[model samples]
Target: MSIPVNTTAQIWVPARRAADVTARGARLLRMADGCAVFAVGSGTHHFLTRGRPRG
Candidate 1:
């Protein structure tokens, strides 16, 4: 499954800060107060996803 990326930006979250969520597949995540939190990162991988997507 190839997710459409901007390519112009890259996002890289620390392995510790990134949470793995299992649904259909393993997904990286981050949350706060039991609810999803907002985040963005440096580089061409930069992304602002509304929520986790099954990878």
Candidate 2:
């Protein structure tokens, strides 16, 4: 899957991959640490933050 660009820390991920930032928003992506990041894109938030996977 292709990762989206961070516009002023704005994260826009695909639908099926949005789960990657649903909850684990910061953990998944270091840059988004401690920020008001919301799911502004499509996709199922199923696989998102299921388990804390340390990168």
Cα lDDT listed for each candidate: 0.33, 0.37
Tens digits of per-residue lDDT for model 2, 12-44: 333323354454423344234333245423332
**Residue pairs of candidate 2 with colliding backbone atoms:** 15-42, 15-43, 19-48
TM accuracy, model 2: 0.20
Predictions: Cα RMSD each: 10.3, 10.6
Clashing pairs in 1: 9-44, 9-45, 9-46, 10-43, 10-44, 10-45, 10-46, 11-45, 11-46
Question: What stretches of model 1 exceed 4 Å from their correct place?
Answer: 1-22, 36-55
How much is the lDDT of residue 24 in candidate 2?
A: 41
For candidate 2, give the lDDT. Answer: 0.37
